[model samples]
Target: MENTGSFYNRLTLQALAIVEGESDLIANLSNISALLNMELENINWVGFYLLKNDELVLGPFQGKPACVRIPVGKGVCGTAVKDNRVMRIDDVHAFPGHIACDAVSQSEIVIPLNIGEKCIGVLDIDSPDLSRFDQNDEQGLVSFVTELQKVL
Candidate 1:
């Protein structure tokens, strides 16, 4: 198994290449979601939630269908956006106001996407294993999003 450092390095390089010469938001998000879904192990869901009309609307994802909209300050995704910070929930059931988009999702990590100071959307990843995400994962995904933001 690849370590987090290497995994993320590879992910970043690939993501950069994927977005090269592609300026379309939806197309880039679709590819990013697909890349994360394909590269990450043990993840049940991978997607993007775009900020629209003061709420998060599902953008592109790979997995089962997910919630269509989430209000700011509600659920993990909303909370991440509301606080403009990254949220790594080890156990979704224990998270207050947790939205159960996937019944089997036990852990989740939400990375708020920002262009300069403006919050545009978020990158959400879900896993079936409890405590699936760690500090390393958080940092790694944050780096991934940082690179992703340049093309958005």
Candidate 2:
């Protein structure tokens, strides 16, 4: 995926435009999940984990069944929210308290979904290959979240 940053950005921006002016959260998330699933390569899963009652609950996703709930400060998705930062785990197995929602998922990226300083959820993507995510992916995904926040 050399030089894919610009392409991804353009694609995500166009995808977001399609959902612009639509105020339904679930509908927007569902479309965004589908867009990621279709656009990203070598990815096993793409989805959202919404924060509810201080816990992460599985939201719109395009993948096999996943864990429904993860406590705040627990697992990759939770940690991203707790830290209010993006997490790109090169090897999920090496990470402490890693949640193995998919046995084939070797690497993962979790981007916190926030409204101002308050985290409301995460955009979680997993891959079957190790070291699948890097700083570039983090930056691109962060931009994706920024666009998403506008519609949220």
Candidate 3:
């Protein structure tokens, strides 16, 4: 099995190449979905939540059923958008006011997808294992989101 840091680095490089090649949002999202689902181990959910109105509307994803609309200040995705910070929770159950979209998800990492100074959406990843996401994961995901902004 690959270490989490190496996994993240590979994902970042893959995303960079894909995003540079595809300029369309839908194509970018589709490739991202496939890459995240296939490349990242231990991930139960890997998707994008676009900010629609006052909530997060589901965009492209590769996983089980996810929450349709997450308020701006609600769950991990919401908090990340509301706070404009990357939210990386080691244990979802231990997180204050965590929304259980997937009971099997023990850990989560949310990266705000930004356009200029404004956030457009969030890249959300969840794992069935506790403490699945680490610092390298956050850094890699943040870089992925930044590349996504330019393409989308």
Separate clash counts for every candidate: 0, 0, 0
| Tens-digit lDDT string for candidate 1 (1-152) | 78889999899999999989988989989998999999998999999999998899999999999999999999999999999999999999999999999999999999999998899889999999999999999999999899878777
Model 2 scores worst on lDDT over the 10 consecutive residues at: 1-10
Candidate closer to the true structure by TM-score (higher is better), 1 or 3: 1
lDDT of each: 0.94, 0.91, 0.86
TM-score of each: 0.97, 0.95, 0.90
- Per-residue C-alpha lDDT of model 3 across residues 1-152, encoded as one tens digit per residue: 88766777777778878878666776788789889999888999989898888999999999999889999999889999999999999999998889998999999999998888888889899999999988877777777677667767
Best by lDDT: 1
Give the Cα error of residue 51 in candidate 1, in Å.
Answer: 0.5
lDDT of 2 by residue, 1-152 (tens): 55868866787777788688888989989998998899888999999999999899999999999999999999999999888888899999999999899999999999999877778899999999999998888888898888778678
Q: What is the lDDT of residue 52 in candidate 1?
A: 97
Of the pair 1 and 2, which is ahead by TM-score? 1
Candidate 2: stretches off by over 4 Å: none
Q: How far off is residue 40 in model 1, in Å? A: 0.3
Q: Which residues of candidate 3, in runs, are more than 4 Å off?
A: 1-6
Candidate 1 off by > 4 Å: none
